[model samples]
Target: MKTKKMGIQKHYYLMMLPGMLWLLLFSIVPMFGIIMAFQDYNPGQGILHSEWIGLENFRYLFQLDDSKQVIVNTLIISIGKIILNLIVPLIFALLLNEVRSLRYKKFVQTVVFVPHFLSWVIMATIVIGIFGYNGVVNTIAGWFGGQPRLFMADPSIFRELLIGTDVWKEFGYNAVIFLAALTSVNPNLYEAAAIDGANRWQSMWHITLPELTPTIVLLGVLALGNILNAGFDQVYNLYNPLVYSTGDILDTWIYRLGLQNLQFSLATAAGLLKSAVSFILITVSYVLAYKFADYRIF
Candidate 1:
């Protein structure tokens, strides 16, 4: 028995060797910089000679006005995106499921999903063009006797702009996941409801949505873990200093501070804190998933 188990373990190691090596090179080695979050990192002194400040980086981060705004902007943008992303896609998927025309359904799905494949950098250009001072959207607003507000440039509107643009980009792709889950729900359930004289609305509310609850909860759990992400590419490309009050996220903040401004320790600490929070949230979610939902990840 022991020999057979040893052979199985040897085979597993052989299968995992390359993947483990890749993780070591890409993940573990880079993770060493997490230590810098505890140090007063300096380019001249390097990682080894850097002074260890322990929790000072965290203390400094909390004390700064910019950091407070940064955290607030991140949470608002992320939470808003989370709500819009889920509600819009799920609603879309539900509505699309009602369409009986295969050709039209496929065409709409294809068109909507296309944006997800495009890079945010590319989409940002399109967004700028549409929402610019004299772009198509602004021109349309002129017909309504309204002035063109700079959605991307205005601090007051930047959070909404981020949420709106992100929803536009990824909602269709998100719908595909919900659609797949929707497909798995038993067709007989719908048929039985119809035979029992249930209205389409009743079937949707009582049967369809209830069947979708587990998948929704699973996705929600995943989204909740990243309540701090707030999207770097979207914010970085779309934001100007005029809108930084509402548009700055932890990711964008870290990139600008760590890479561009070279505030290594401070930036790393911000990222580290986000990571710590995300880790705790994900851990708690998984525990709940197992305890309450009886779901196992592996």
Candidate 2:
């Protein structure tokens, strides 16, 4: 019996071998390049021979004029998206779950999920057309005798645009998880609530919402890892010079520094800072998940 169990465990280990190897090769190995954060990295000299300047790059990063603005923009946009994304999806999932027609529910889910699969490049053009001076939005405004606003170019509105568009794009896919959580809720609980004179809203508030709390906490905590990630592709594709003041984020800043400005060392330092923050957030998230949600990811 012991030998049979050992053999079964060996098979399980074998099944995990490929994924483990891939993670080690792509994820763990590349982490060694974090050394560039502390060095004045030179391509010609390469990483090994690069001049070591411990914390200098980080110091320079903090001293930059736009650093504070960029961090503020990143946090505001990301947190707004995070909060909205969770709320929108959970509400959407609950509403969809209430629909009696399975076909209509699936159709709505499909329509919403379609946007998630669309690349940001494609969506950017669509957004531009809708928000442009001569576009649908402005044309509609003109009908109401309002001014044609430059949405993509306005610093004041750009962050909101980023957040709104991101939430619209991702909420459907996010709701899928919530929908799945809804399925795990026992039908008997609803029946019991209904027997006690609970309405739909009452049942949802008293039973369904409580049942979904663990799932919500788990997803919310996991999302904290992205606190510093303010959608690089979406923002990069949509933003221009006019909006950079309020829309520029850590990822975009890193891209400009490394690719455009050739300040590779500074960019790496910024990237390192982001990764460090994300790691801490994820760690805290895991701890919270365990404590509040009674969930363990690892």
Candidate 3:
């Protein structure tokens, strides 16, 4: 009987082998290139034969005048996106939950979710068309006697644009998880609250929100890991030299350094720093989630 059970489970183990191998080959193996971060990496000499200069690359990164600004931009944009992503989705989900009309709920959900499926490349064009100097936004402004402003070129508004567009793109997708959590909540709880003199708002505030707390905390923890990633594709597609002072994040800076300027080692070092910081953030977030919310992602 034991042998039969073991043989049955062996196929399950075999089913997981391909994915494990893929992760090893693609993810784990490439991490070995991190050694290039500490070296004066030469393509002709290759990684193994390249000259090692410990911490020099990191020193060079900080020496650049734009480096601090880039780091600040990344954090500001990412953190803003993270907060808005959670709040907008939660509010939308709560509002949608209140709608008794299933047809209307589904229609609204579908409309909002369509944006998430569109690639950033396509969405960037749409965003530019709407916010350009003579675009739809300026046209609307003109109707109200407002001046035409160069939104894309303005450093002051670039970060706001990044955050707003990212939130608009992803809020619906994020809300789906909250909506699912809403489904698991027992309807009887709502009924009980009503019998105890609770109104719809009171029921939602007391029963619905509390039930959604664990899921919120778990997703929040996961988001903390990406605090340094400020949507490279969107920024790259929409940004210009005029806005680079406020809009350039770590990834864009790295691209220009490594690809355009040929500072391979410096780029690698910057990337390695980003990964290390993200890992530490994720680990700390997981620990806090477990401690505070009794939520364990793993």
Candidate 4:
């Protein structure tokens, strides 16, 4: 078996050469740049000559109030997004599945999916037009005897707005996965339940939901792995210093520290920390998925 495996390995390696080269050049080579996080890295000093500070960069980050806020905001935003992301999409998918009219079903699905394709910069402009102080939401609220509120400016509401917008943008794309899972469920189960006098709600609760558990669990685990990444593009586009207390996440914090403040070493350290946590989370999730949920992407 070992000899045969070696023979097949040669053929596999030959076929995978180009892709392997791409990964090496693009992914692996670039990761070596992470060494800057451990050093008082100077661009002129280059990688080898930079003064090594060991874990000083990480320690300094933990000592900073702004850094702590970044971590807190990242977790809060990500968790909020995760909950909303699953919920709205699941509800929409279930509702869409019930629609009898093919034309309306297609139209709703298409319209919902449109936002997923839009860039966050463009979406930010749309959000401003709808949620800014004079925007649609405040305008509607004003008509109801409420004062015009700054939705984006208020730190308390920024997280909510971020999660809501993310949900709106990504829900349709996520619904596609659920819709596919729903289609694969055996119709005979629904039929059997119907014959046994199960109503629509009962059949949905018993048949449809149980069939969706594995898929739900699978996606839940994947989302959990990404719980620190609250989205750079969205937050960067939508946020300002006014709401940074609640809006600054790990990625955005790094952007300010490195790009804006020119503290490249500190920013790199923060990024490396996030990447390390994400790596561990993803690995653990994959293991659990295989052991209990049988989640296989391929």
* TM-score to native of every candidate shown: 0.91, 0.89, 0.90, 0.91
In model 1, what lDDT does residue 60 have? 90
TM-score of 4: 0.91
lDDT score at residue 105, model 2, on the 0-100 scale: 89
Question: How much lDDT does each candidate structure score?
Answer: 0.89, 0.92, 0.93, 0.91
Candidate 1 overall lDDT versus native: 0.89
Q: Which residue pairs clash in candidate 2?
A: none
**Please, what are the lDDT tens digits per residue for candidate 3 over residues 1-298?**
9999999899999999999999999999889989999999999999999999999999988999989999999999999999999999999999999999999998998899999999999999999999998899999999999999999899999999999999999999999999999999999999899889999999989999999998888888878988998989989998999999999999999999999999889998999999999899988988888888787756
Error of 2 at 68 (Å): 0.9
Off by over 4 Å in 3: 1-21, 290-298
What root-mean-square deviation over C-alphas does model 4 reach? Answer: 2.8
Candidate 4 off by > 4 Å: 1-18, 142-146
Candidate with top lDDT is 3
Give the lowest summed-lDDT range of ten residues in model 1: 288-297
Predictions: Cα RMSD each: 2.2, 2.9, 2.5, 2.8
Q: For model 1, how many clashes? A: 0
> How large an RMSD does model 3 have?
2.5
What's model 2's TM-score?
A: 0.89
Candidate scoring better on lDDT of 1 and 3: 3
Candidate 4: count of backbone clashes, pairs at least 3 residues apart or interchain: 0
